[model samples]
Target: MEVRSAPSLLPILRSRQQGEVLTYLMCDPDRETSMSELAHRVGVPLSSVHREVERAEAAGIITSRRSGNTRFVRADTDSPYYDSLSDLLVKAFGPPHVLAEALEGVEGIEAAYVYGSWAARLHGVAGRRPVNDIDVLVLGEPDRAELYEALGGVEGRLGRPVNVVIRDAGWLRDGSGSFHATVTERPVVAIEIKKQLGRDPVPQSS
Candidate 1:
């Protein structure tokens, strides 16, 4: 059985709990979760969940409200809790900041954003690591040769080759005009606005 800590300890303990809440919310930001459910998932009692939820709400870590008889919870990443949770995530997942320099400093590269499972693990950043091949969503409609040039730039920068994706709305349909549901289905982690913009360029945060 877990003993309830002193009132003063609540503040200290809430940080970790806040991180848990954020992790859940990050998976699906729109849905609402209940206090009882959250307590069960976290292995804490309802009363503690209530108190922590209240504190987190005040700190803007999460937003809570009464829906009839239930209190719902979700992570507010824009809140300061984001920084703490991000740090915890890095500690939990093996650190891989080295990938940033590899992807970022390449010439002719329009823009890059991470997507997929590895991207989910990174803090609101959309890229995965320990991946067999890096999956990056790039922008523009460069020809195959031009695209190869851009990809080569990334390969040179990273000391390893990475697949480069150039997004083009104009190329939405090929000769057959068939839909490429594949690109639309790509999992999105975060939408990045490029410091260097061209077309509808968005970065996948890492």
Candidate 2:
């Protein structure tokens, strides 16, 4: 017997690549992204990203231009579907970037990742049920109270609960827990936290 999987996070899109492409471009409409950068960020081949860009361009979802030997693209903000599509992508595929932005300036966070079912979908894994929440793994000694406060409204923005698991860097390097083993073996989306200058590195009490 065979089992069937549920639809992806955005069933309206034809493929995960399509969703990823749109998400990266639409979520950051103000910036122009190079094709190579898009491919690198989307974790797909250049040729594959090019095809998706062409399809999106043909549909007026994005616009592209060439500079020297590189091609840059951004969301077509003039399109009628731009607003709604961007909102959808933000809710469906924008966790890593969104969470990264939200976590910025909070002291003592060395690294972060989005794992579990939402990440499984981002990794193109088909599941029996749709993802209903986001799981985040934070490796650092960030103040728990500050951390939670930073992420307080993420659920309201993403339309799903955001579950965060915090641990020290040592745990990631040498932990023997079953949970650590599972997360290490699975696909996890890395979240980049930009450290702000002039901010104290002290970890506040919870």
Best by TM-score: 2
The positional error of residue 26 in candidate 2, measured at the CA in angstroms, is 1.0
The deviation in Å at residue 21 for candidate 2 is: 1.2
Candidate 1 local lDDT, 86-185, one digit each (tens): 4443233211232333434344444445454444433332232443444556544436575465446544333344565566544323312322354434
Q: Worst 10-residue stretch by lDDT in candidate 1?
A: 90-99
Clashes of each: 7, 0
Q: For residues 101-147, what per-residue lDDT tens digits would candidate 2 score against the true structure?
A: 88996788888888888887766677888789999988778999999
Off by over 4 Å in 2: 1-7, 196-206
Q: Quick one: RMSD of model 1?
A: 13.4
lDDT of each: 0.47, 0.79
